[model samples]
Target: MSTAAAPAPPGDPALLTGAGARALFRAGLDTDTVGWAAASAQANLIAVPRADAYDLLLFAQRNPQACPLLDVTDAGSPATALAAGADLRTDLPAYRIWRDGEVVEEVADATPYWRSDMVAFLIGCSLTFETALLEAGVPVRHLEEGVIDPMYVTDRPTRGAGALSGPLVVSMRPVPAHQVAEAVRITDRYPDVHGAPVHVGDPAGLGIADLGRPDFGDAVTVGGDVPVFWACGVTTQAVVAASRLELAITHVPGRMFITDVPHTAYRR
Candidate 1:
């Protein structure tokens, strides 16, 4: 849970100067996370102007479950990040472009996807919830087995806004019968990202009949204990698919948009 701060590479002289570094450094004092680390990495590669940030945030906002809003860069300039020090254009390991809800391409760099009107948004993931489970001694099988957590589409629906609304997506973890209450207590502290369990026990209660085959991520063994489900950041993507917008983007399932802000920020 504790790690050293990663150093940001340098940015382009024409697009970014040392000023951005100062801004990022100040922001980092308040928050830090893996996604922020990637953003800092990109600032060294190219200019992530405010325009680029706008595109990134707008994309995330349009698809909140998948792209939670973490931090944003200034609108015209690239120097200040509202949340983390990382730049948006280069830090991410991969970027997916979608046309009318269909992903058309995947690339390492998002510079081509950059447009002045766009904004960046960072969504919450089950990572924070998993942390709470681990602290309570609830075995998180996916992490233990070195596999991604299993995700499934449920009959549950989320609050719809703008063009986003669809069936809820959830990430599952098997909790011992003894620690279920402990898991709930620890996670209830944060709600900005999905907070607390949406469903517990039978998966069928949420329209998920098969635990062995998941709609996304990998499946893990479910012992004689209860199978727990939490709201997923990817739920927004399901909404996007249902909306059928002309253009949309999201991180691949399991692949997430990291941010500099600590997971604790969601407590607010």
Candidate 2:
């Protein structure tokens, strides 16, 4: 694998296959995957010790909108049902290593930090629905601006399960005022990947004081469009931090594990 940082593969990212995207990351392309493999499904990864797996699973079940689960690997395994022949440790653009509620390090490959008892959870990501939004003529501002999508932590609390609990996290997109309904209509079809906007219009309703400052990812200009919020899988990181787990592994914010599953597979 190349140690040098590489740019996105030269081509239309929307036409890239899931396996093709993984190959790029495995070879050392460390960038957010917002528009890459637009036709395929993408996932947020959160791998925890087997002892804590049950609690995390319960948390997802209790809060499906924020933590829709696509696949959960058996303990100690690096493979997932979502992508055949893919190595979880190195296939994502980046990984975060957490220790006692704090992000200790971010790395291109997670193999050095992986534990034998780890149980990897593949949670559905909102990025999986972007293709649908674009196909319906709804603009994805971050993609248009060539920046990462912005994510925020809301004041709303998630349902607790065992030792796992945290505030709801959301990803925001600026939708044309006239196309807000169409955007909602398109996204609502993919319930497995954060179906629809949890909150729209005023960011203050979600307790977000400023649109320019975001907790994770880059903030984008909203312009005349309405700000729409969707439940974010990054809520797992918030839970990892809030619960103060001894150790946890997750995909970097905005960087996801591309899956062979097509976006249509999750459409309602």
Candidate 3:
């Protein structure tokens, strides 16, 4: 299955939810339309043969913070259990075709790379909390500015699992001083989705020297707000880049699988 890239998806994003958002992606939006999860990111996906699935699972379980497994596709299938009728190969707007830890191609549809041996894992994304934060009166500056959230590689090291290990990656948001506490309380409820701020107020604490420049995604104005940091799923890409597996595929950083599962399903 495949989707053709359109200049833009029709109608309004405010009216789109769940499957409607999935449909917009399946229709082949550009690589930049990261509205599905508010700001989807890289995922822990494997295209290796079934014989190696066990290793991947071990890696995922060992490093849950960076690679929280949401749903894993049955061997050879592009459809995930997380979203019915969702074709993993096409539903996401962008994909990174990897070879030896290198991105060989970036494409809108990944049907050309689909393999019977592949298993795609849908990890919980922090972006899912954007809706909650907005409802709670926290402004998502990136959404307002129409850009992906700023992501950074931190001095923190992620726990190693099998061959997957890398530095912690984080996404940053400028929350107003008064709302920072509320943001934490609100996100603290969704542990499955990288809940709560790993670090707050000072980006320097995370070894991020310049907030204006991020290792991944786009930067937004910090203004009068405090920079709040959260664990980001993009750390998986850091592992992919570090491990340099012979052949693999992942959602391009900031391009994620939008699952049918509600963000609240992860509240704890």
Candidate 4:
């Protein structure tokens, strides 16, 4: 019997710019594993065919908090307006290929699944706020622990768009009680990236039964701190699961597409 390998420590978020991280990911850093890349420097990507891409776009528009769109690639293309010279096929550390809404395979390269009519959409993720949190002296637990943050699908319902609608999904971080106000104010400035906390404190209120277990990502030690929840791009995956689409491609949770945009761009 073999035990699974522990993921290597995710890179320092403060060290890499968006384009720098994309270049590194494209060159094969932690590009083969399902892991978190960077906190403040991550964005989500999803690819679907031209015939079905519009549905995702409309779905994103309907629930901007959960699926904020940053860039939409041209049909059959891998490059994005958000990150020049970036290849969507291999930049993310992991990719999930879905069929009929179920993940049929998880891969590192999406080139094999590439189709002539496929279009990729880049969405804003809460990791976009990572740098600011660190800069303000607020700890980023996932980065410190060398793992992905916890994510939960809440009891909350997102407004429907066509056939895509599901419960709101959230990424969580444990924040010290005193600085919670500062964290809220700092993240509130970027409404495009999930904005502020949707809920704070009690997990049961959001229908989360255990803080140690999460729907996605690795759970962190909440300890003496209160748990803070933010709307997450993973909500789109829930929609995809619910819709049962014939085919879809998405960056594995937390393995995001680092863009060319500076993290500071989101600051007010």
Query: What lDDT would each prediction earn against the true structure?
Result: 0.57, 0.93, 0.76, 0.81
Candidate with best lDDT: 2
TM-score of 3: 0.89
RMSD of each: 9.4, 1.6, 3.0, 4.1
Give the alpha carbon lDDT tens digit for every residue of 165-250 in model 3. Answer: 67889999999999999999998887777877899988889999999999989999999999999888777777777877766777
- In the range 1-268, model 4's lDDT, one tens digit per residue, is 9754534434654565666666556655564222233333468888988888878888888888888788898999998877777889987767999999999998867899989899998888888787788889999898788778889988888887776677888999999999999999999988778889999999888999997889989889889998999999989888888888778899988778877676677777
Worst 10 residues of 1 by lDDT: 38-47
Residue 44 of model 1: what lDDT? 12
Task: Return the lDDT, model 4, position 135.
Answer: 83
lDDT of 2: 0.93
- The TM-scores of all predictions, comma-separated, are 0.70, 0.96, 0.89, 0.90
What are the clashing pairs of model 4? Answer: none
Model 2 Cα lDDT, one tens digit per residue, 99-135:
9999999999999999999999999999988888888
lDDT-best of 2 and 3: 2
- What's model 2's lDDT at 139? 90
Please list the residue runs of candidate 2 whose C-alpha ends up more than 4 Å from where it truly belongs after superposition: 1-8
lDDT of 1 by residue, 1-268 (tens): 9855644544431133223433443333222122223222111111123423443345455545444444443443322353345455544445566666666876645656766644444466667555445655878888667677899988987655544567878988898898888877776666656667888999999999899999988889887878988877666557556765555445556644444444455654
Stretches of candidate 1 off by over 4 Å are 1-83, 265-268
